[model samples]
Target chain A: MELPAQTFQVTRADLVRYAGASGDFNPIHWSDRVATKVGLPGVIAHGMFTMALVGRAVTEWAGSPDAVVEYGVRFTRPVVVPDDDQGTEIEVTARVREVTEDGLTRLEVTATCLGEKVLSQARATIRTAR
Target chain B: MPLDPSFVGRTYPPTAPYQVGREKIREFASAIGATDPAHHDPEAARALGHPDVVAPPTFPVIVTMAASSQIIEDPALGVDYSRLVHGDQRFAYTRPVVAGDELVCTNTIEDVSTRGGHGFLTTRTDVSTVGGEPVVAVWARYVIRGEA
Candidate 1:
């Protein structure tokens, strides 16, 4: 079954806070000058930040914060933040792939920004009964 | 320059212990907009059987990123930090990390290869408690873009 999609807003301020919280001080995340110099269109969200938002969606679906047994994702594209109040939106959706007799549920996840896939091969296994 | 394939299977010494503080967990969760009660309230976490507030799934990167410096900074390994971008990430948890746990990471070079003039390096980090209890294993792949 297809799960309801969750959307998140990413802004420059959010990136700054994430950098401090996550200890990733790469200038490309905060400085558009640095980003453009690096040949990026503009500032982009950290791949891990996008993954964390997806993780939030997964845990919310599983009804427990500690339910994840395994999670993985490949960074396919950058989620560019326009340095404005509106920033960008990331939409996360997932589907049930399998459920084990041992109570594990596997989900295939998709995360998109501006209609472009940001992460591919995204999957998570959770202990649904725990 | 391509990463040396010989670095594969090489393991770095365990990093110094990192204290997982409740506020740090709360900060990380809030940064990602994760407002689960288990991540913010110690009482709520304890009610859920965790010793204290639990970390969000990707929180361990904070520790591993620092620990992995051992390899990225290895003079012999020769990683160009400026050109590196994250390619993929994975985590397998034995249990949720709780606040007050002192964690150590042992980093190992899992793979190294080059294709299309781009170098790929994959690192695996074994996270365990200071007392040696296994906690989680994390894998991260970084792509070093070919020099222009």
Candidate 2:
């Protein structure tokens, strides 16, 4: 039930594409002025978008998209995507908390934005193909 | 502008049932880059005791968001979709959502208020099977920023 640790990098372009595909055109996600006007420090990625990435990390580890049975997360902090050359990176590490008698594997997930936890108490239960 | 308190306890009609499909689950998982086998393989899901491939917990968003359209389109509710921003969301699950389940959602406006010049609205949606088995409850908050 041990899961491999995984990490991912999210760029402004990724945010833009996610916004388009998800039909969430909120300017704060892509426009600095709109972000600042909303009293945010700068552009922030969509929380759902980040959660989706976390979901991907887990599914990728399982080796197929359909292996997950349940997943949830709480947005603890905003992922402030800097407009600088460095952009932003999210590192996600997942460990198997338990494997139930029914074969449901519970995972404890941690996602960091520049080494600080952006999403906390993330977890998923996936029915493994095995 | 004050919201109608009468709407607070009102529950909307149940949305038409959405039949969960393997292809849609795979598409959603792939779009999010979830490579979990239980999300895609029925044999894998059955190995884990589920009747079929089960969806990731957050997958309920697909159904509940559609249910929210009822409130968004309510003229008396006064929701400005253009000005609205997703504030927050959380889910409590009674059971996992698996493929082939015909599910319906009932949405209720839990609360509405204006604070710090921002309009805040909270809605709760209950998702269940066509047979009336409860699956999950989703709570979402939306914020409408004040005009400059």
Candidate 3:
């Protein structure tokens, strides 16, 4: 079954908050000067931030905060957040790849930003919601 | 400089215990815009059979990232922090982390290789309770780009 797509807005303010919360103070995520020097288009969202948003989508579909048993993703591309009131959007979509006999639901996940895939081989397995 | 493949299989000492707090979980959830009550309200988490406010799945990164510095900062490894980029991440959970749990992480270098002058290092962090009950295992792969 195909899961409903969820879009998340990521802003500079959100990145600041995430840096504080996650303790990842990488300048590439917040400093445009450092980011440009590092060959990024501009300040980019933390790859973990993008994964967290995908995790949120997974839990929303699984219907529980503690549903995940396994989750994984490859950071294929950066999600660049332009400096503006409107940051950027990450679109998360998934399909149920399989359901184990023991009630595990495996989802094949995808996340894209601005029409480019940002994550690859993204997958999550969750306990089937009661 | 390419990473020494000999570092593979090296295990770092366990990190100091980190107490998982309810408010920290809430803050992380809010940062990610995760509105699940189980990540905030203890009562709501207990309703879902958790001992306290549960953390979102990716919350473990906060702990593992700090723990993995043991490998990243090793002078013998010669990893240039400026040239590093996260390539992949994976988590396998035996149980979700909840408030009031004291967690410890032990980092192990699982693989190291150089391809096309770029170094790839894979590290696995085993997160467990202070009492030694495994909670989750997180794997992270980092790529160090060679200077052109």
Query: TM-score for all predictions?
Result: 0.99, 0.72, 0.99
User: Which is better, 1 or 2, measured by lDDT?
Assistant: 1
Instruction: Give the alpha carbon lDDT tens digit for every residue of B46-109 in model 2.
Output: 9878898877756778788778989978998887776777776767677778889899999998
Regarding DockQ, does 1 or 2 come out ahead?
Answer: 1
DockQ of 2: 0.27
lDDT of 3 at B89: 99
lDDT of 1 by residue, B1-148 (tens): 7889999999999999999999999999999999989999999999999999999999999999999999999989989999988999999999989999999999999999999999999999999999999999999999999986
lDDT of 3 by residue, B1-148 (tens): 8899899999999999999999999999999998988898999999989899999999999999999999999999999998899999999999999999999999999999999989999999999999999999999999999888
State the displacement of the C-alpha of residue A59, model 2, in Å, after optimal TM-score superposition.
8.6
Q: Pick the candidate with the highest lDDT.
A: 3
Clash-forming residue pairs, model 1: none
User: Residue pairs in steric clash, candidate 3?
Assistant: none
Candidate 1 wrongly placed segments (more than 4 Å): none
Model 2: lDDT of residue A6: 70
lDDT of each: 0.95, 0.79, 0.95
Q: Judge candidate 1 at residue A46 and give its lDDT.
A: 91
**Cα lDDT of model 1 by residue, A7-68, tens digit:** 99999999999999999999899999999998999999999999999999999989999999
Which segments of model 2 are wrong by more than 4 Å? Answer: A1-6, A11-44, A55-87, A92-111, A115-130
Which window of 10 residues has the lowest lDDT sum in candidate 2 chain B? B27-36
lDDT of 3 by residue, A26-65 (tens): 9989999999997889999999999999999999999888
